[model samples]
Target chain A: MNAIQIRTMAKDFILKEFLPGERPENLTDSTELITDGILDSLATLKLVAYLEKSCGIEIAPDELVPENLNSITQIANFVQSKQAST
Target chain B: MTVAALHEYLEQSARRYPQRCAAVEASSGRQITYGELDALSDQVRDHLRRIGVRPADRVGICLPKSIASLAVLFGILKVGAAYVPVDSLAPPARNAFIFNDCGVRAIFVEASRAETLRCELARLAAEPCLLPLDWSDGPSPLATYLARVEADGLAVDESARPGPDNLAYVLYTSGSTGQPKGVMLTHRNGSSYVDWCSDILAPDENDRFSSHAPFHFDLSILDIFVPLKHGATVFLIGEELGKNPTRMASVIAERRLTVWYSTPSVLTLLVEHGRLDARDDHALRFILFAGEVFPVKHLRRLKAVVPRARYLNLYGPTETNVCTYYEIPQTIAEDRSAPFPIGRACSHVKARVIDANGRDVPRGQEGELAISGAPVMLGYWNMPERTSAAFHVDSSGRWYRTGDVVIEGDGGVYTFRGRRDRMVKRRGYRIELGEIETALYRHPAISEVAAIARSEESGVSIKVFYASRDGHALSLIELKRFCAHNLPAYMAPDWFSHQQLLPKTSTDKIDYQHLMRME
Candidate 1:
């Protein structure tokens, strides 16, 4: 999966994990994930598994951080940025 | 509270209720009678002694909720050693930190957890023998340890000889510091708390107790030991209880449980969504809640269900082992929070609300609480400086700071307001302010820092507000690195809010609450 695809999947997972209700398949850019309590604690843990399996990338334990895995946008940007640099 | 010693008490109960049921693992549908709990605890105790686990040595217990775990806990106490209970499900690194922090001599784990338990012990530079749970009465590794180690002989005086002065158990609690602090307790403190609880719950031979809290959490001290001391049976609810409250409610009613101990949040979940009918469980006699507040609305609904069962609100931190408690009057349960109150301090425990300067505050003025009594812990294990700071001597060296704000009310009743200190609790873990402050100050772009706990997202969160330096920009990575450098994983703030200048009160002290609300 590409960075965009992974972010969309993570957004979907967070929505289900928190709200536990049906959601739109295509998330818009203006998704208020944190403001609406969509993504919460254990975000980094959930995202770690998803990213390692989906993008074929490994997350260093020290890399787990709120800012780095706070939401779909930051996560996608982090993945893309890391891949680009590597 | 001149209760019989642990072994004597269990022996008496065993003789009295030989055929009556004592322990049950609902997940496995395995039940042990009072006679069985007494017998198994004795076996575990004797086995432990045959090994070299001398009396008063720290023994770590890492296992899931099961009959073996329950038996080992009581057995450890029965033989006179303090058993440190660690939740098997918690992060292995965190558990490893706790094991290292306490310098536990040995740990008993199930076969499944033995690998991880050994790994943690190895990281701590200690060689703790891993005793598996599948002993099947066939070469029980623990049984072998009990048999082989000469030092693991009988408890001092051939019984659990811990008077009020000995360390009962050292519970490792959370902080930003990588090391967790173990709060030491004594047999006397536990018995005092249990004495009050047994009297309040009035558990009889027929009463059945539902154990919900993990053995590690102090709440279980009452749920597991109280029943054993009272000769009542305990229905050991496992991790399955966390998955579905309805299933657990069924266990309570189906098993005819007579006593329940859990957090207010769990009871609300069961009542509101699990559709629990408290009245249906006629066998249940008491419901005790600690670790959080029980809202007034839910109290009424509970009364409507269990009209005969008593509902108690228990309050205290790990150090105090549950000090103040209120037995819910049925009228208050059916009415409003107004009729409810934080009850009087337990027997022999003295409570005083004091100010920041350590002066006793007048009634109705919110101030930090200082508690002095048998229940105050022996201070944090291995952190003498931090322990001394919190556990201090007044003019007479008689008081321990509670860090909680309370107000004196009519008839010696006290009401809780908020905390006077920065150590806040979220999801049942105590957080240290200094840890977060140290983390925030590390941001290269930050010149000064203050972290405070504020209400957020339906729970408590660390609101870290810092003053930014003029030339540098505070990158998110920089901030994360700063916290990751000096604090424990949990002490890191969930949210960071930057400010040009921190607000201050008239006395030049940081207005922490005001700064918290800046965002």
Candidate 2:
């Protein structure tokens, strides 16, 4: 999938799973997810599981930092980079 | 050496191991020796006294977990005042209620949170004195007060020495009522639990303990004091770091933490995402888990990865401290699905599984567990009715009802059955379902609500079934935001379901069993 497609999918999953009532327009690509407490430890883990299974990417323990999963843009970029390397 | 007050542990440790490292901030790599910790707390104590804080007063601490906060805790104890710690991340309104309920004379808060908390307390009739721990925009910082006290050369006030019965701290827990109730713990109550754990754990000066629990949590009592009593090092784990399993695992390996204590959920996360098998440099000797049951499968995996570490399951409410403990044995049958038992009572306390009539239940039968001994809390703060109702005063002795039903097994071992009340444990936090209902009732759109907790694969998740007053569905985002503003993040409901009418029993009560079936 393209970067835009990846971002859209991840954002949709986050909204449906973590923020059930949140509007799609509210979560911008650059919205702070981890830092803003939108996703807690449990939610973050679940998101990671979704990304790994759906995108067919392996996430190392060190890659679980906020730098990679803090926002939709960051998550898309991280996934793209992993796909490119593979 | 006898220690009457909790702060005396620091005093004794400073004398014995003056130059030994006492605390470490794991994220920032900040370290404080025992001598420095003691001296810093002395400065804080003098500053508190100069600000008109007297013995038996209550002081509120609203700072993130850090070595500096540890010094403030000791300072509060040194003044013979009980410290009330509120979650720095909790809503300002919730914290304001606690500060008001306990009548805290002064609050030491982080500079960033000071303005928000000050504004919240503005609505209270008697506002507490706000002392910012760091640099603030308005009021002079705590450093300034400490500096002024240091320059004045104030003599130590021996008169402020507290007896063993004096209040040490008040830990607030969720109450069935909308308001949170404070569990009052005295010096003896804290020391007894610490002494018992220290004896069993036998941590030495070389041991390094991880302070994973927040200062507001009851688990912090053992995390901070147990290490100080033994002159060991306590590495403070920040909230963010604590949430990241990979980083938490690395911290354990990098810091060479010997004694690790936290809720089982954290450990489960570590087992799932931490990649523990890759790191062999960890010096973990004891791994302690409490609050919720560890799924047997995950526990087996954790044991396989860190086979050398002694695993223990501790059991207690904030009111009773760590009254019962079970040490995990070397091996478990592969097909075992049941979680390990909570084990026998600690040597310092007595545990009895009593029936509804307060009589001891027969072995293999289930009843409420009652604890009576030194570690039992003094009572709920300022709530005589609750304090009296929580205990059974028979000729045998006063026993605090745990509100947890447990079955008596062989050799006096107690196995946890379930809670007798609406209280539920999620991520090591005790949340009262009624508290959520009460908060939701305040919302104009919500007419009737019932909160129920269901055990999910991840853990406990609360579901709130509500009926709207106007026969219209409320926006879920708005409802979530409403809960966020009034309650702590953990206490907020995970799911909101709207129903036209809630099911009721013949007794005219909400049918909770029917709701569970719906789930």
Candidate 3:
């Protein structure tokens, strides 16, 4: 999938799973999920699982930093990079 | 120097190690020495006094975990007042309820949250004075307030200092009722636990402790105070880094943290996602876990990676504060599946297993665990009836009912069976299913609701089953929003199931067992 499609899918999953009842408009692509307390440790792992399974990219243990998963755009970028390397 | 109050630990440490690092922000690498922390807290105490705060008063702290917030906490205690810390990330309404329930005269909060919290408090009858922790615009910030008071050069009133019996802090826990209840802890109660930990851990000024738990959690009691009592440094793990296991692992190695205390879930995350096997430069000497049971599988794996560190399982409710502890053996058999026992009572406290009649149960029999000692809280905040009901009085002494069912194993070791009440531990936070149900009942559309907790491999997940009043379908988003507004995020239900009618027993009570079976 393209970068836009990846961002849309991840955002949709996060909205449906973690931030139910939250307005989609409120969650910008650059919104800091971990810092804003929207996603906790468990939720972060779940999001990682979704990305690895759906995007067909393996995430290394060291790659689980905030720079890669803190925002929807960051997640999409990380996923694209992983896909490109593979 | 003899320590009479909780803040005295910091004072004594400052006198001994003025230039030693006392606190460090893990994310930003900010450091504060003992002298700075002591003087900063003194400024906060002066600011509080200028605002007419006195001994026995309640002050609320709603800021994130940082060195500044820690100073504010010690300042509140120095003024002989109890500090009530609410979750900065929780709903404003919940925080407002806690402030009102405790009748806080003043609150130190983030400037961004001050307006919303002020509006929520306005809805209630009480209007607490809000002192923003940080601000660029609007009301004067805490720094400005403290600086103005410092310029006045007012001397602290030593006569108004708190005694050992005076309250140090009030931590609110989930109540079966819709509202939360504050557990009132005094200087004596806090000192008992801290002294016990210090004696056993034998920490020195060179030790670095990781402050992984939030300020509001009971685990933070050890994270902040124990190290201060020994002139050690506490590394404040910020919220963003706290959720990232990779970053947490890196912080442990990079900062060379010698002491670590947190829930089992956090440690599990580190073991699974942190790549612990890759690093070997850890300076850890003690690893303590509490709040919930640590799975044996994860514990085995963790011990394999960091075999040199001593592991301990500390057990207690917030009302008791580390009344019991167990030292894990160096080796576990590969076939072992059952979790280790909670072990015996701590040196400062006496723990016993009693039957329904409050009489001591025979050895090896299951009974409720009751603790009696200096570590037990004085009582719930302003809740005389609850305080009385929570304890059992006899000729021996008063004992606080823990509501935890356990069995006495070999050699006085107590093995946890389950909770006698509807309370369940999720990620080390005690949650009452009834509280979730009560929050859901507040929604106008929810006619009947029952909340239940299911133990999963990841941890406990709360599922709420509800039926609408008009038989019309309710949106999941709306119900979830309603719950988020009323309860803390941890207490929010993970799943919401719509039912035409909730199953009930012949006595008209909801059949919780039936719902569990369905799941």
lDDT of 3 by residue, B198-311 (tens): 888999999999999988889999999999989999999977688778889999999999999999999998998788779998999999999999989999999998989999
Comparing 1 with 3 on TM-score, the higher-scoring candidate is 3
Candidate 1 per-residue lDDT over residues A22-56, each given as its tens digit: 33543344454433333433443555667777776
By lDDT, highest first, what's the ranking? 2, 3, 1
Q: What is the lDDT of residue B123 in candidate 2?
A: 84
For model 2, residues B259-359, the per-residue Cα lDDT tens digits are 99999988998898777778878799999999988889899999999989999999999998889999999997999988899999999999898987899
Best of the candidates, DockQ = 2
Task: Please report the candidate that would top lDDT against the real structure.
Answer: 2
Reference-based TM-score of each model: 0.74, 0.92, 0.91
Candidate 2, which CAPRI tier? Answer: acceptable
Candidate 1: misplaced stretches above 4 Å?
Answer: A1-13, A16-86, B4-7, B134-160, B176-178, B277-282, B332-340, B392-397, B427-429, B433-452, B456-515
The 10 consecutive residues of candidate 1 chain A with the worst lDDT sum are A32-41
RMSD to the true structure for each prediction, in A, is: 9.0, 3.2, 3.7
Point out the higher-scoring one by DockQ: 1 or 2: 2
For candidate 3, write residues A1-86 as lDDT tens digits: 89999999999999988866667887779877765556666788889989999999988756777789889899989999999999
Q: For model 2, what TM-score is found for chain B?
A: 0.96
Query: Scoring model 1 with DockQ, what do you get?
Result: 0.05
